[model samples]
Target chain A: MSEFFQQIINGLSLGSIYALIALGYTMVYGILKLINFAHGEVFMLGAYSGYFLASALGVERYSASGQSFPLGLALVVLLGAMALSALLGVTIEALAYRPVRSAPRLTPLITAIGASLFLQNAAVLLFTPNPRPYPPILREVRFTLGGVIVTNIKLAIFVVAIVLMIGLHQFVQRTWTGRAMRAVSMNMDAARLMGIDVNATIRATFAIGSALAAAGGILFGLDQITINPLMGVLTGLKAFVAAVLGGIGNIPGAVVGGLLIGLAEQLTAGYLSPDYRDAITFLILVVILVLKPEGLLGVVRQEKV
Target chain B: MTLVGRRWFCIAGAALLASFSACKKPGGGAAPGGSGSVTTNESSGLIVGHYASLTGNTAHFGQDTDKAVRMAVDDANASGGVLGKPVKLTTLDDRGDTAEAASAVTRLIDVEHVNALIGEVASSLSLAGGRIAQRRGIPMISPSSTNPKVTQVGDYIFRVCFIDPFQGKVMATFARNTLKLDEVAILKDVKNDYSIGLADTFKASFTALGGKIALEQSYSAGDTDFSAQVTAIKATKAQALYVPGYYSEVGAIARTARRLGLKVPLLGGDGWDAPELFSIGGDALNGSYYSNHFAPDGASPKGKAFMAAFKQKYGTEPTGLGMLGYDAAALLFDAVKRAGKLDGAAIRDALAQTKGFEGVAGTITMDKDRNPEKAAAILKIVDGKAKYEATVGP
Candidate 1:
């Protein structure tokens, strides 16, 4: 019915944001073989950066009339956040991950958690623990498609998310750096033997993944209309689950997982009780883990003793 | 160090520390209540301890209360201190957590040796702190915790603001009488006691008033998505939506509801009063209504003077929570003056007998339950700002 169709639209938009953030987790895990728990904090930082950039540009002052959609200003702020988040991502990798790379696997994992907590507290200390309302960048305009109300912001989020995914896909398939990334992910020692600079490749992967997450953060702020220091915690966890469900470290699987998780969450909330939304998302993860072990698109690999 | 020697040393050390703490407790208690032998020099000034969420999710509530409390203390000291001695206020940050609130109260009672306590804007936090103050027999007053269970903690606990049941009825009445909306949908935060209590009361009152509830949905606190709930409510084609949750989520809900083309005006409770409401809800909340403790935009002479004084001190408009803080402190100060002593039992008796205490929020008279019987104000969001509408009384 119309209500069903309406939920689908909501699911897709929500799924797109999850997908954008999932790509970051998948790419970093693909290259580093490490779950970057701090990636969520990176997403939070991106939202804050975008918030500051928009404020610096006087987006609020100009949009006070509520009639103007400052798309250009929004884009500028988004791109600025992307760039800053990339830098932060690279810096975190260098300081936190690189130092503990040779240590036990648990060491780096703990470091990632530590880094996440540190960044969250630092944001709290800097910004004060109040939630800031994200500036209205797009005017509130709605259009109906067969009884389903779709806003312009929702359409823009879907379009931008798809575009970014396509751009990332093409970059990975067609570029030399992308090939180097795939090479490192396959066999870091072998890639080094093949004259590939593994460290640079890893940094590049982090940068690109972080840029994608930043885009997700900005879009989420726009969609939800509020951003806080702790906003990234639950969201980051969900996207990580999405990546796992899609088969962690598999590019296409992350997209599929993100969309499926989004759809499942929205459908569950719409049809059932909202209290079960988070429970259902994790339940899917458990079912997938129990049944397949490997993700939907994940490939089984043989270990040589 | 041999094993036996180390064991004896540990036992001896623990005993020494225990005795020291035991001695300190009676010493601290004796100075205030004249019940023990130990004497202290710092008992000359009447100390009032306050704990609130000054640095966490609900920091705005605590920060506003802290400002208003400070203004009240300054005014009290300028006129004449309580018990003819300077009244000192000590505020601790509870970070909006129950465990932290309990610990904060413990510190105030045991360490600071405060004669009285004020605090904990959130009901859950107040419940935690109130239990501690009740055990210690310290008179504690909450500025804006509206849950009835707050005062039910103990006879020593009190609140200046009206409870959630009254607030819920006020909003329900406004919806049925003022807006004349017959069918409504309620989206409540199931994880929060305040929201659940308010929603229940509103639903009961609305149904009793011959108004039908078209739909009812629930969400947990801190949830960012209300799409499913909004869609469900829209499908019901209700005349209005009642969201009994805090401003953080309500603003997002309002935006989501409007985006889905549900044009009926949203109704809410005092939790919707916050500066962030405008920023998040924007023009989408233009015509929504909410019942509040006191509308800062009202034209009462007492309210106007309080607003002017608060603005002069804080350089911002006083929020409803801030006004409640000022009123609670003023009420407590009046009780202290009436008690004519720094004794907690005496102060509790005075607070119980409080009648017609003129506060900036309203004239308050404490019932047997220690809840202030006062009028609730209804405010409408017009052009992205809250305008005072009407005051509904019990």
Candidate 2:
């Protein structure tokens, strides 16, 4: 029973990060109707930024002395990483996607892929192709809840993810730029005629989505204690699947899909053969798609606010 | 003689006859190749071909191996040229891809017409290159490819390093006799042939030695998360966790295991030897033990000499793979000198009869399967360094 509960906690912890990455894919698709294949690399760049941030802030020196990082310093590292990732997201959009915006539909898609490859290789050149140890931010503390094991880092990840998602929901519902984003997502020409700056709104969406992905990256580094250039490839693929599973343009649906995917993955790995965890996760996506094409939480056709 | 011994004798006698007949001809070193074909090199000297990962994710392994191999060649030339001709080397970059490895070997054999081949630190890449070398009847020796399937490519495929089974058994023996653990859990990488091969061999050998496997689980390579597997092990009666995986995954696994509070001595194979292992695993790896070919520190006398020479040449301490590369080249040069020719069959025969040859890594004796039966070094991770533990004899 404790093992079952432990697996659930594990699933939810992983699911939170997946949701963070899925939100990026979902938001980009919601705005431009184009799947940003490079979103995964954005997440990777986020982790690298966090690594740099920690190193620059002397967290590495503090960490090397076997001390847990202070809360204030940890927050600074997280925010700094997110800010840098936002810049990177905007840069990628301006450089890679914006040029091909008015081109053939397949052009942007292909450019997205090329951008993905470029970012991955650039990271290799920038960071070198070695797994770097992410400085431990918080001294690890484990909490047992009714025989189930939960670590402080996992809990923090879960809380941060939920809070960010809720904040994004509120922003989209209540803010002017959010209104412009929704309007543009609904009908770009109509929103353009209504004086909404579609390009800026789309860039903001990338910025927000990328920030969330960065948060996920930091949390992942904290959890796994290592970061690498190609770390995002499979993870990004899984998050992309999560987005599709939740409804590509549905924000809340992405969260649901990510959590479900995480839970399914852990349960399959814990109860059945770990070899089939990936195959089974993909199978669920297929089964869900076959049964309800839109997604569990997604509405058919009427996708926009 | 035993049937196998008699067969070896017959082949050696035939090779001798072939060499004598070739000697009677105008130009020597015209001995027959394995595939009943002959390669004639109009170019100066014996051109030795090498295929390496030169530029890729594993480029460091390539660079290290390349340095040691060239140094070995330079040493040979400094003493005397082989067969009255200076040995010339041509190396191609495989970029750590199997397709590239295959193509590189093909180009080396087909275009350069190299007399002998050496290289490939990775087992999978070695397997890829070895097939072409075997098909073309070119004698190839891998410096550090440790998979059992590598030598199984053909009689032409050989490795200076011990195979996975040998290292696996070494660890298993250490675990049973040294660590004295009767039960353990295994968390392996299903996606890696190295991890799976090592795990399988360790499991079999440990079980044979009267140890019980408490539980078994697996994860794929590139997987950073191991909560499910670690939790399952935590629920078991495991005294230790045997994780036969590469350093990248092994380090992460160790961190997770420690974080989950499943404190047990970790056991691994040679794949766990890397500087990154310390940074990634940190203090989690303190109690873990791994089997390796040789240690950079506490090396044999010959190994020390090779390391000193390597440091003089490259201005850095040599890695275990570097020593293996040097040994592979040194062994090849010795065999070529003994063969007194550039013939594939003669070189192959000479390599097969190798016994008590003092390599920098160890005194190597070629087993019938073309692998070296050697003593392995077991090292424990103390703090951030791999401290030498005990030398386990095969």
Candidate 3:
């Protein structure tokens, strides 16, 4: 029972990170009806940017007594990564998606793939091909809840993910821009007719989603304490699965889907062979899709001509 | 009446001119001894090429090997070069792709005019490259690939590392005799030739050594969850488990196996040498052991010197892969120096005649097939660190 609870906590912690990243995917898909394959790469770039920021700020540099400086560097790194990632996201959508906005829908999908590959390889060229070592900031701190051991950093990550997710939900459901986004998503022609800038709304959606992914990526790096050029590939795939599993164009569904997938993966790994962990994740996704094609929280919308 | 005859004459003249020009080949220069402009010694300068995965998943291995070769070549050149006229080293990146590896070897032989070659970190890639080298009669040495059939292709194929057979025997002997385990379950990686080869050999050796094989299961690479397989293994009442694969899968497996309450001792091969294994596996990997060519701590004077220099250069202790790369480079240089000439045949003979040559790993002597017959060391993981346990003789 103790082991079970521990595994659950592990699952929840991982799921929360995935959920944050998936929200971005779901939000972008909702507004644009296009999968931002490069969103995952944006997450990777954010992790690297955070890493550089942390190092530049001497977060890991030991003092004379072997103690690190306590200057809120982690927060600084987070803000820096978020800002840079949002900029990159806006640029990607503007250049890649904007040009093909009126073209065939398949064109943007292909361009997204091209952008993804470009970012991945360009990262390889820009950074060292080898994995970078990420030094931990909050060491020797642990919190035990119901026999499940977790560190302060992990708790911070979970707290931040939930807070950001709730903030995003509020922003989407209550804010003026949020209504504009929903208007655009529901009927782009009507939204444009009603004096809404569909293009700007789409760009805004991408920026928000990308920022969330960036935050998730930073947290993931903090969790794993390593960064690699291809780190985003698996994360991106998982986020995509999370989006699809929750219903691609549904925002809340993406959140629930990400957490469910994360739990399923962790629980499977804890109970079964680690080799089947990824296979089981995919298998569960298939099962869910078969049982409920509309997803756990997805609203099946009727297409109105 | 005369027009038809004139046209036929002109067409015949054009045909004769075209055939005359086609008969003479272009750039037909320098037939052997044609210029007699051979003032320089042509029989001694040898060019050795390397084909490695330098730009993909396993690029680190190739990059390290390339660095080692460069270091060795620099040292050799400083000492008056191989076979007198400095040895030239060229490289091709296979990108960890087999098709690319094959074509890279073809290019190395045809375009680079290399006399000998070394490379390929993985078995499948090595085998693919080895076939081309063998058909073309080029002597190619693999630095890290350990599958048994890697050298079985032909006389020209060889490896600096121990084969899977010996590694499997080492693991089996340790499990049966040291661990005193009678029933063991096996987990193999299906997609990797290296993993499958070692697992099959370990199974054969384990069952032969008075150990009962409990169950055997397989998993493909890049798989992260193994709950179904772990549950099956747990039900088997086995005392130990053998997981033969790379570090990535092994780390996740070790963690999951413990979580499933099936904490049997796990055994593996050299692929478990990555730094990520300990962090990912954490305390789950304690008491596990793997077979490798060399351990940095258990070093002879030469090995110590090499380790010191490597640490001085790289700020970290060199792993077995790094040492093997260094040794392979040194061995090739020694052959080049002994031949005192760069001719392909002379260098091949020099390599074939290598005997009692000492490397940082161990003493190496090439057999008729050019494969090194050397002992292997068993390293134990205690407290997330690898310690040399014992050495198995040849």
Candidate 4:
């Protein structure tokens, strides 16, 4: 019972990161109808940028004393990472996707893959193929709640993730730009006819999505305390699966799907064989796809010929 | 416009022909010295080849080994090269992949005609390269690959580090006698042969010593999450935890285990030795113990000199991998001098008959199987630094 509760806490924290990353995939797919496979690399860059920013700010000097939560420095690093990642996301879109937008859909998909590979290798060349230990922004502190140990880092991750999700929801629902984004997602031609700037809407989607992924990356680094160039490959793939399982392009569904995947993975690892964790996660995806076709929250749409 | 195009096409054709001719000459030069042949220059320099994971996930291992090998070569040349012939070492990066390791060995044997081979810090990569060297009857020595199957490839294959069975026994003895921990949990990397082999040996030895394994869990390499495993282990009443995996996963495991409030000391094998370990595991790994090939904190006079020289050259203390690499190269060079020739068969015979060759890591005596018989060092992490605890012998 204690083990069960402990795993739930772990699952939620892990799921929050997945949800943050899944939002990027869902938002870009919602607006551009493109998978944005290179978003993982954007997340990786964000982690690296945060690492550099923290190092430059001398976070390690204070971290040695086991100080809990260098909140000001951490926030500065987080924002810097998000801003840089947004710029990089836009540049990647302009250089790789925009040129091939009019080409066949497969062409842009291939370009996204190409861009991902290029960025991974580029990072390797620039940083050397070694895992850098992430500076501890929060001191290690844990307290047992009914026999389940909960760390302050975990709580911080949960709070920050929920806050970001809420902020994004309110922005998309209450702002004029948010309405324009929804309009473009619904019907790009119609939205253009309604005096909406489709290009700006697409760019805005990339920027917002990239910024969210950057936040996820930094949080992941802080929690795991390790960052590497290829860290994003498997993680990105899993988050993509999470988005699809929640009905890709659906905002709330992505979060729900992320939590489900995370819970499933933790429960499987806790109860069954640890080796079967990844296999079981993917198995759930297969079963859901076969049974529902559209995700748990996905709506059926009629096509007019 | 037609005339101009024709003239440019003629020039391009001529340039292509010239480049092809230039490339063909080196190809022809390499053919005469193929298949177990030794390539010696006019200066009587013997060609030797090395391959390791210099640019992949395990690049730290390769980079350290490569540095030590270079230092060894420089020392050998300065003190009158092997068998009075200046040794020329050619190293290729295998990128930590088995296929790449095999091809690199092939290139060394077929193209460079190296008299002997060295390298492959990882056991899987060593097995791949060792098979080729064995079939070709070229002597190959590994610096730190401890899996027994590596040398089982053939007699021509050898390693300077003690095999996993002995290392596992050493740790088991330490846990039972030194640390006096009775019940332990085992966390192993299923994908790694080294981890699996070490875990099996440790479990067997520990159980034989009347210590019980309270829990056992497995994870694949490159996994970042160990929460479920840690939670499960936390539920157990185990007194200690044994994590037989590389530093990459072990560091993360240590952090996760500590975060979950499992305060028992963690134990591991030589795979835990790397600079990144401290950085990744941080204070979480304080008080953990691991068995290694060599410990710099308790060095002999000769070992101290080697450490001083290494620090002077590389600006850091030599790691176990680096020390083992120096031993491997030094052992190979000693065998070459004893053989008194650059012949492959002669070197193999000398290496087989090696008895008590003192190396920077330890004194290595090659048994009939070409595996070194030596002692292992136990180190404890205190205040984020590895302090030498004791040396356990087989």
DockQ for each of the predicted structures, in order?
Answer: 0.40, 0.29, 0.05, 0.45
| Global local distance difference test of model 4 | 0.86
Q: Give per-residue CA lDDT, model 3, range A69-88, as digits (tens).
A: 46477678788889889999
Cα displacement (angstroms), candidate 2, residue A84, comes to: 2.1
Candidate 3: share of reference interface contacts reproduced: 0.03
lDDT of 1 at A35: 97
lDDT of 4 at A49: 91
Query: Considering lDDT, where higher is better, how would the candidates rank from best to worst?
Result: 1, 4, 2, 3
DockQ of 3: 0.05
Across B148-179, the per-residue lDDT of candidate 3 in tens digits comes to 88888887776787888889998999889988
Encode model 4's per-residue lDDT on A1-305: one tens digit a residue.
Answer: 99999999999988888889999999988877799999999989988999899889888778766565477877898899999999988888876787787788899899899889878877876787777788776666789898999998889888988888899899899999999999998888999999998888888888888898898898899887788899889888878888989998888888888888888888899889899989977898899889986788988766557
Worst 10 residues of 2 chain B by lDDT: B27-36
State the TM-score, rounded to 2 decimals, of chain A in model 4: 0.96
State chain A's TM-score for model 1: 0.97
Tens-place lDDT digits, model 2, residues B30-135: 2223221344664356777888876565566777888888888778777776777667666777867889899888878887688889979878899999998998
Question: TM-score of every model?
Answer: 0.92, 0.90, 0.80, 0.93
Deviation (Å) of A261 in candidate 1? 0.6
Across residues A94-163, which tens digit of lDDT does each residue of candidate 2 receive? 8778877888889989989978987887676567676788887767898878877789999999999999
lDDT for position B364 in model 4: 88
Model 3's CAPRI class is incorrect
lDDT of 1 by residue, B284-369 (tens): 89989999998877646887898999998779998999988988888888998898877889889999999998888888899999
The weakest ten consecutive residues by lDDT in model 4 chain A span A62-71
Each model's Cα RMSD: 6.9, 11.3, 11.0, 5.5
